[model samples]
Target chain A: MTIHHQSATQLTRIICAGDISAYEVTTASLEQIQAENPNLNAAITICAEKAQAAAKRLDESIGRGEIPGPLAGVPIVVKDNLCTEGVETTAGSHILRGHIPPFTATAVARLVNAGAIIVAKSNLDEFAMGSSTEHSAFGATKNPWDHTRVPGGSSGGSAAAVAAGWAPISLGSDTGGSIRQPASLCGVYGLKPTWGRVSRFGLIAFASSLDQVGPFARTAQDLAAALQVMAGHDPHDATSTAYATDALNTALEKDIRGQRIGICPEWMSGNGLSTGVADTVSHAIEVFEKMGAKIVEVTLPKTQEALAAYYVLAPAEASSNLARFDGVRFGVRNEANTLPEMYKSTRGTQFGDEVIRRILLGTFVLSDGYREAYYRQAQRVRGQITHEFESAFADCDLIASPTSPVIAPLIGAQTDPLAMYRMDEFTIGANLAGLPALSIPCGYSDSMPVGLQLIAPKFREERLLSIAAAYERHAGQPGVAS
Target chain B: MPDITSDDVHRLAELARLTVDSARVETLAAELSDITEYVQVLRSVTCTVTPSPHAMSSVRKDEVNPSLDREELLNAAPHSDADGFIVPRVVG
Candidate 1:
């Protein structure tokens, strides 16, 4: 069997059944990463020795008559932003190039505890800043489907790694559609849980309130398996929710019959939406209807404002969160005669254009005289957007939309920053409302994947996964680009 | 639409503690202006959005927690001595 192509859930079952050693699975995953990484640029740091050591440990444990953990021996990649103890965690920026995290993120630690092997660290936009991985100081990750096109980001590398078959599952962080947009462009399943569903102990923060670590996988069931391990509270993160995550895997078995799927006309027919996307979504809605689900038109009139609000609010938060990287404590430092000069030159040279642009914009908005006009007003609009979602959810069990307005653009097709920001329009609403949302491949558009996104109210991951699982079972899994 | 002047750009950069190269200042000014203009749409919107109770109010109880040892943390620092992180003199 092609072990690397198997889903993480299936690989675990196979490994536990003694059909394959965990070491063999890890080897195959490592080999795949080595083979595909040059063309895809999906992984920024490959951990062959560490992965082999981990796999050997798991295999020995299973040989000792021990019951394998939930994900036993599944090879996974994590976005560069997530800290891994003893391994370099760059967050795809030059500032932290050689900085090895002393501790691991709670989400990655939980996955490791569940018996998953970490094989590599995937690439992303610098500090998870942009819609495309082009913002990475390393280099942009190319779309596996079309080399000229980009793998959507800032979780672009995680999604691309899964699509390229380097690993069956990987982790990504979504502050504003980082996970889902990339997952859509790559033809995989990505889930952004309720804001506090997954702990953010060591995730390099871009926007604290909106950022949540999520899983990207080839199948919804595999995504559910990952979430089973990742979701829960941590003493380290006060924002981590204590919500019960039991029965999430079991919830995948439920059907979507009698469920109300909301379709917002404003979102579906919004500007920038291509005919290919609209047609693909229309067909997906029909699939749900055929399965005895009801489709209803719901209103979220404030949907358009979400994009603007996210930009303001996210940058405002980022400006504060990123102040820690000043040359003194950790990471790269440039020499200067004075401490303040050291800070200015170190940051000025290390941060990428997009990161600096955001920092400056954030400073401008949060500046003394302009706070009311920009930051405060954006916060109010964020509340209104959240309220719009809550009101819409009252009439529907789940809201459905295209994960992105259009297919993945060519790698350099979107040089203008505002144009790139528009790519996340369809997916940012969930972030604003702090809702759980899933993006699964609906169909192909221009040969690229078109994602049908299903969003549920806060803490309703079970609903999102169940619906996604039902759709995947019927439609069959989307094919990866060769 | 708000025009972001070169002065505004420099002031914002100073506040952010980020040095904007003179060569890139003009481009940054234009880009910042575009973004600011785009976000200005929110100014016309009026809605009552209360702060989320859980988001604003939730805090873990102050408690003892296991933390990374000092050596491991110091190892990642740019400059450190036996005492602690070494930096340029703070006292002028």
Candidate 2:
């Protein structure tokens, strides 16, 4: 197989064994990125020189018989929201167009420390506010399956890059389906680890509580391998968990027989769920049953209300988290006479429309008169949703549903703001409840891939991976879209 | 649900410190109203449980570590000097 076709696990083994040099793999990845990025626009920044230098160093270390890290010599892509020291991290917003962070995000630093070379920074929706990647300041990423359609967002570029064979693994942050929905549209695997599974030290914050950094890969094992390196505690981030991540790689190889897979009928036949996606996910359940896995019908009545709650809670947090971007500090500055004028002009002009809309909505929700009615009420609902998921997990090991309600829509197709928010109907519950969730390609609909979402209780990423790996063994890896 | 009027949008823009163009205010008002109406579903559901923030079980000792280079951080600012970041005249 060509270097681009090999998974990260395969590439590492070949490089370690001295059969193929890391330089060869890195060059092939860079070449593919250069040739295909123009048509797809999946990557915003390409680090050819730095990637080549890093790959050459790995080859030298291997030549000397020294062991590099577990992910030695694998080329990876990171979503632009995660900071890479001295590299321009824009978070897909013009406000940070030329801002180079002074420090690296803990998750990205961990991957790099493990010998993974970053080939590029993928695109995302501005501040991860929108479900469709069309909200990005640097143009929309076209779906690899069909260019006319979007690849999903705000992590659309990361998902598209993996789907288009630019990289085997990429990192993306999920606020509300930013990772999983795009993974579904692009026909790849994407996971949003439990809220504190990965550190958020240097990730440009959209919603502090809802955002979790995870990986996108073409193979389930690649997802596990990437997570094994990225997960764990970071002292810099207080919210990072001290839980053990050593079992992730081993868990994927275990048998999934007799595992209880929960199916929620309300979500399965929920409003606006496309018939194509519904049928594909239902078939996935049958396949699990055929493989000796028990399928249980579970009820999560409050989950349908999660979408409304998330919209309120996320935007409310965004207003506060994003308040740091005044004209005086880092990022773009608009010259003005007064300091207050500078803050107003800089934010008003630099932030995109969606960002402004979100900030306004956030401000309104948290406003004095409406706080009890909207913001506090949303928090109460968020608590209830978490309780609902906890109760449902007692009957099942994992919950299964459609990752996205529909396939990738045409660019500019979902201009209505409310319509765009509904794209995350099935996926927001996981984020609200702070659970580990993943999307794996189950089948194709309308010649495009559909994702089967598996959500597990907090800190249970291993179980999700084990079942995903088993399903991949049966369903086969999705064909690369070129 | 009460309709989001132009005055409401103006007030929100003022509070958020964002300048909205005259051309866009009407559209913003309509969109915000529609979203507000949609989210009114939350009122139908009762949630009496008190929301507890996620537990932070791994907070480290409060010790000062080496910070980033002062020059490097100052250099990223739009206006900075040997002393600190410079902003528009506020006290004058």
Candidate 3:
């Protein structure tokens, strides 16, 4: 069962039935990412000779007959903030340490044109601000179930390289709750989508309207086949969403009877949840009320002003999309001698300290007497949290909640900064209302992992990945990391 | 709700060109005044809704594409060569 514990839809159906050979499952996923990325440091650029030369050219174009696609040779990873053309991509920041990216990242070029293979480059938090990836400057990733916790993060190295099996699927991004809070602290199945349902061109910018990029599987049909090969529309991401996406592996054999499913009740009687994540989201809403859905409850009533309007509209759009890392165009420049000391000594020694405290609280909420008191009252409390998720999806069809209200702390537990921005109180109201959520893993507390989020609306995402593949087939799998 | 001093972290590290280390400007003026007093709860939440902005604009077809490769982005800049990228001397 190796090949890094199967799943990219079971290694693209046994490498399209040749019984195995996408170069022997990309050489057993580059030998389980070189024996589990040094005990789960969940990758930071280990493209083993460009993923064994793209799995030996998808095993010589499937022995000269072709036909593969739909993620053929599988293997994956991504998330060093997308753009991967010659790799380096450091969004986990050191002012783009040894830059590189001369392109590629229309969702990692639609998962390497649907035949996967990337193989490495995870780590995040620096430019993705933080929720722990211990604000990565290329370090903290742990939590392959618990190496003193913290795998939850700005896509904590693509959810600890898909819960340590070293990639069955990966890609990461999601602005607030960087990929479902590190795929709910590395248990797996993350999602996010919907915002512009996937295309963010090269992805680097932090809060470009609460980013998107998605995927991080461990099931739910390899997160709906890596969201049907990284969802659609591109023309280099002019906020994508031109449409035609739904084909989530043919809505994973539908089944959410009588649907409904809302929940919320001020997110399960609030107060920063955690009673084993509100009894594992009330046993995943009583296993979706024993598979006939309905649940109800609702009332998003401005889900507590979505973590204070996503910390003032994602640090006022990450200080205007990181005023393009000045140090003369790209990265590493610092020698200074005016030009504003080379943009303050190359982003003050290649940013960190929570990206220079969110670019000085996003240049003090877009300065000039605090733009109508903090970025237009956090864009009118982000249009009342997108009209309370459009009036709770006008009476529910998907909501759930509790992606992270607790669990996975340990790794230097909360070193303030508003206690690490309340570790994105239950995933920043679906990235401040752009919607389509997901997460999954629902169960386990002191023994970590909990997640269960869901969400939906806006580009429905094939009914949010067929209700997370019918609650991941009645909450079974989710364990891995051995 | 004022507080973040050290001259507002030296005018927000001089409008975020960012360089603040006077021993971390009194701990970034006490963590930017505890995150601007916790995002002043979005200025007491009285939203009369209007903000829209969620980016779904599209537009294309203004022609002229194929760009990128000015000598491989001027050999990834940091003070490039061949008539480009070496900034600093803003006109005499």
Candidate 4:
């Protein structure tokens, strides 16, 4: 049967039943990546040889009577920001054009150990900086549904790759809607776990407090399966804590008959929601009501500050984390007569205009004179936003909103850069508060997908998944492009 | 707003330890001022003190862990030699 782009859960069932060998699956995935990627530019790097080798290894294990691990033989792509051994890990930046990670990221290792094959490294905005994948120095990853439009980013390529059948499942990092926004813009399922739930040891940091590794898949079940493997603690990542991921797995069995889904009023009042975006979300709220979910209209008053605080806080932390890329150590470095000159020249020359703008802005915000005025102020407001979410959750089980203000924008549509940043309006608040959030395809407009976002309190991913699964099961399931 | 002057932009650039393209500095200066003005909206909110937002409070127990080897760390470098990544001269 045509299992191309089917959920990994669905595909694995077939593999277990012996309908297709892992080799067949892997080769199909490779061919899909090759055929589809050129039109979309979703892949920044492909590993055809290694993928074949990995598929062969899986096939031998199955022959030897070894139990195919969970998600056995499913192919997945990863955002380039995650470190993977033997593959170049440039986060769509000229600075790290050909840099490789000698040791694999824990998330990658977990997926590999679970018998999943790596397909390719997907494109992204430089250093995970922009809402559109357009900022990539390598090249923009276009939305699969409409090539003229941007694939929402910095995980746009990850989301778009899954939507386009290049990979059934993929990994994306969400510092501030880096996963969900793209997953929304491209019709797919993306989940950002509560902070510290997933190990971040090898995720190249965009912002320390906000960065989270999440799974993007064609279906919620597939997302849950991927997260079950990738979530948990690594002593290597001090911020990541240990957890029994069975909570997420068990969520599928949780009854969502009487759950209270929060209809956040802040979403309705927001300025940028397109007619398409609002209609899709309104339809979702109606579905929740019909499924016996008590819908409560909730007010998160401080949410107005979410956008401003995210920009300030994410950039402030990014300025520090990205300092390692100077010519003194790794990645691209232009030689100069002096060491100081080399550091300046390398970054100034290699980094893109958007990345440079961020560095300068971050440098200024965190500067000695401006620290109290900008950085400290942002921290205080971040606290307020967090408190606002906590208070809102006191009356609701899952907070719901539109993942993006609109479907993917046309590539380079806005002349002003700050106007482009405004597209992240709906999803950034969850990141600021360190909450678990998911984006599931709800409806379509102009043949592009819109996502209905469900957020839960810290580490409450299982319940969030339960709500999403119930919705997906009834609403024709997520991942089908309209 | 600070009504930031050209000298202020030059000084901030110096403190940031990079040279700003002089041509772009004026436009950037205006944008920064607007952003800084916009961010002033936060000053009105009073927050009850919380030490830090981190959920895990106690220090993580120090323990032995397997780290990426020297070769692994050096693999990310753009310019490396037998000893390690080569640089122009830190001790100028």
Candidate 5:
């Protein structure tokens, strides 16, 4: 297998034109991923055989004179947390090191059915627990732009794989900032749909209230295309909305004419965003303004309180969701003298430091004496924030902000846990409010990429994608972007 | 004073279903006190007694859905045979 670099759409065009076979593209993508992944550490697991077989099937379909799908012969990567039948879905944890799903996740299976080849499973913070890929039990995925720095996580591997040309597009989950943060750092387009926009059935739960599966790609068009095929209401996941998936490519055709944009007070305050990030976001807003969009100053008053509420809420939900990992069921186990010992041994031995820390904090807040005072109070604040967002949208069509408060922090410079947790301040509120948001690379921080975020009301994904896809042509992130 | 004791650590660990080595219990107890103190920030937040982060209610259905087959559910065990998940037997 000789490795080469080509976009997913480009590969499909090639196969459509009979320039190459799907098998050739899959083999080349795997070979290229293998060659670069050792340095990138983006791929948590590679499934070359399954990918090749799938490609063979696509080729067979084409040979039979049947019309191929839009993503036919295109190879893609997926985050490790989404289940793939017969393939290990470790979620970057030691406990599920060899755990394979009997059935594929609804979203992933739908992607396969749409004819996109699943090439690899990307690394993440174990259980999507941290902003940095450093928390991944398997090891950190490095920024392809500069290998010494992180690829921003827990979808770091997915973003890095796309940015590094290991894959043209990838699937990721955002609980808080997992998908967008990493996409920002890796210089790609990542979108987390409104809380219920995408199906979450096959995904291993993290913070259940905040978790949303999304797509990552080099171009906003690719992200939109991948999302169209991957999103929809699954009767299995009650939270999924009933909207028909938006044809992401249509917005690029409609043009972003008269699109109204807002640069919120939370985004403009340089205190939170780095100088480079702030400057680039401002420049992007300027570009949008020149392109006939109105920019306004909007306030998200509850944003400051989001970090605290998320800290309490995410951990609380995670603690409950993760309780299912007890050794008596599956995963790693240690002999316990009692039934309680089974729970003790599984989480104690299997969970990484961050996961344990979150669980501890979660349990503390949800405990009897503190339940009303802590968890209940945090929920109240979250409600207020959601209301604030609904009101903010009344003033602006779409809210724009810098994705993270700052550029990617140095790999191990984090000595304070609270400071590390604050990294998701700008991005988490969208998740908290169950709103759809996209992070597209607007500029760079030194040599690394930075993202500008656009958020829209729930079910207005087409508008959000149209606004984002318009900016796709004039500028593309350099060095690291796929 | 909310200075948690080793007894408190043992209890909270049990509530959390976590295993803490004897050597770490004393340290954890000390850390828990400081954390509990830090967590007092939540008390300062005033609200209308209405719980904030509303639970996603639509997740549950009133209709009782069929559970996964007992055989398949048990088969998900790491170490399973025809009848059950084989764990270290605990006998009093």
Candidate 6:
């Protein structure tokens, strides 16, 4: 296989065995990105010189007889939201156009420490507020499978980067369905780890509680390898869990035989679920059944309500989290005579329409006379949804559903804000419950990819990975878009 | 849920420190109203459970760790100097 087409694990093995230099792999990845990025728009900032330097350093270490890290010599893409020291991390927003972070995100740093070379900073929705990359100020990322279609967002560019063979693995942040939905649309494996599984130290905050950094890869093994490095505790982020993550890659070797996978009927037949996606998910379940896995019909009545609660809760947190971007600190500043005028002018003119809409919604929900009815009620509903997931897990090891309700839509297909919000109907439940969820290609619909979403209880990423690996083995790896 | 009027949008913009353009106020109002109305489905949900926040874990002991270089941070600011970040004067 060509260097860019190989998975992270394979590339690492090849580089470590002295068959090829890390510099060679990094060069191939940079070449592919430069050639395809113009058409795909998957990458916002390509770091060719930096990546080449990092890869050369790794090759020199190997030449000096130093053992390579697990992800040695692998090329990776990171969503622009995750800060990279000295790199202008725009987070797909015009406000942050020239802002260079002083520190790298913990997850990105971990990947680099493990010898993964970052090829580029991929695009995302503005502050991860929208479900499509169309919200990006840098311009929308086209799906690799079909250029006219969107590669979902706010991590669309990361997902498309992997699917288009620009990189073996990429990092993306999931707040609602940002990671999984885009992973689905791009026909790659994307995981939204249990909320605190990965640190959020330098990730540009959209919703502090809901945002999580995870990986997108063409293979489950690549996802496992990426997550193994990205997971664990960090003192910088108090919310990061101290749980053990050593079992992730090892668990992928185990089969899914005798595992009980839960199927939520409400989600299976949920509103707006396209018939094509439904068939693809059903077929995926049947494949699991054939692989000696038991399929249980589980009821999660509150799962439907998670979408409603997530919109309120995520935006509410966004309004507060985004308050830090005033003209004083960093990023673009629209100078005005007064402090208040500057704050208004900088935020009002810089933030995109979706961001403005979300800020307004968040402000409205938290406003006087509306807090108790909207924000507080949404929190209560969030609690109920969490409780529902906890109860559902008692009956099954993992819950399976369609990752996205529909295939990738045309770039300008969805105009209504509400219609765009509904794209996350199935994937929002996992984020609401703070559980580990993965989306892997199950089949094709309308000649585009459909993702089968498997959600496991908190800190059970191993189960999600192992089951996804097993399914990938049986279903065969998804084809890379030519 | 009542429709979010342009007046409501203006009020929200003021509170959020966002300037709503006169040309976009009507469109913004309609969009916000649609989202709010759609999310009103949460109102029908009978949520008796107390809202539990995400549990905090592994909070490190309070210690003075080496902080980022002030010069680097200052350099990233739009207006900064040897002292600290500079902002528009708020008080007379």
Ranking 2 against 3 by TM-score, winner: 2
Q: What is candidate 5's fraction of native contacts?
A: 0.37
Q: How far in Å is the alpha carbon of A103 misplaced in model 5?
A: 1.2
TM, chain A, every candidate: 0.99, 0.99, 0.39, 0.97, 0.96, 0.99
Candidate 1 lDDT over residue span A135-238, tens digit each: 99889999998889999999999999898888888999999999999999999999999998999999999999899999999888889989989998887788
Q: Compose the digit string of candidate 2's lDDT tens values, residues B20-77.
A: 9889999999998888888888888887667789989577888999989999999888
What would the per-residue lDDT of candidate 3 be over residues A39-105, giving only the tens digit for each residue?
Answer: 6776778888888888888888988988989888888888888888877888888887888978888
Candidate 4, residue A133: lDDT:
93
Tens digits of per-residue lDDT for model 4 on A1-482?
A: 34656679877778877787888888988997898788789999998999989998988888888898888889999999999988999989998988887877888889989989998999999999998999898898999888899989999889888888777899999988999999999988889999988888788988989999999987778888988888877766777877667788778767787888887776865577888888888898888888888888787745447777776778778767877888666677788877777777777778777776777677778877778877888888888778878888999888888888888999878656667777777788888889999998888977788888889998899987887888877886655342
- DockQ of all predictions against the true structure, Cα-based: 0.69, 0.79, 0.31, 0.50, 0.40, 0.80
Better of 2 and 4 by DockQ: 2
Q: Rank the candidates by lDDT, best first.
A: 6, 2, 1, 4, 3, 5
Q: Is the docking of candidate 6 incorrect, acceptable, medium or high quality?
A: medium
Structural similarity to truth (TM-score) of each candidate: 0.98, 0.99, 0.38, 0.96, 0.92, 0.98
* Worst-scoring 10-residue span by lDDT in model 2 chain A: A299-308
Which pairs, if any, clash in model 3?
A264-A267
Question: Which sections of candidate 2 miss by over 4 Å?
Answer: none
For all predictions in the order shown, the interface RMSD in Å is 1.8, 1.1, 9.9, 2.4, 3.3, 1.2
What TM value does model 4 have? 0.96
Tens digit of per-residue lDDT, candidate 5, span A1-482: 12335666777788977889999889988988888887778888899999999999999999898999978887889999999887888899888877877778888887888889999999999999988899888888888877778888889999888888777778999999899998888888899988888889989999888999999887666777778887777878887766766455577666665776766775577545677888888898888887677887777744557777888888899889988888767566777777777779777878887777677778877888878877887788777778778888888889898887677777887745566776787898898889999998888778778888898888778877777766765664233343
Error of 1 at A288 (Å): 0.5
Best-matching candidate per lDDT = 6
Model 5, chain B only, scores a TM-score of: 0.63
What interface root-mean-square deviation (Å) does model 2 yield?
1.1
lDDT of 6 by residue, A1-482 (tens): 67778889999998999999999999999999999999899999999999999999999999999989999999999999999999999989988888999999999999999999999999889998888899999999999999999999889999999999989899999999899999999999999999999999999999888999999998889898889898888989989988998778588888889999998787888598999999988998999999999999888855457888888988899999999988787888998989899999999999999999899999999999889888998888888888888898999999999999999999999999888988998889888889999998998999999998999999999999888888878877877886
Q: Which candidate model has the greater DockQ, 4 or 5?
A: 4
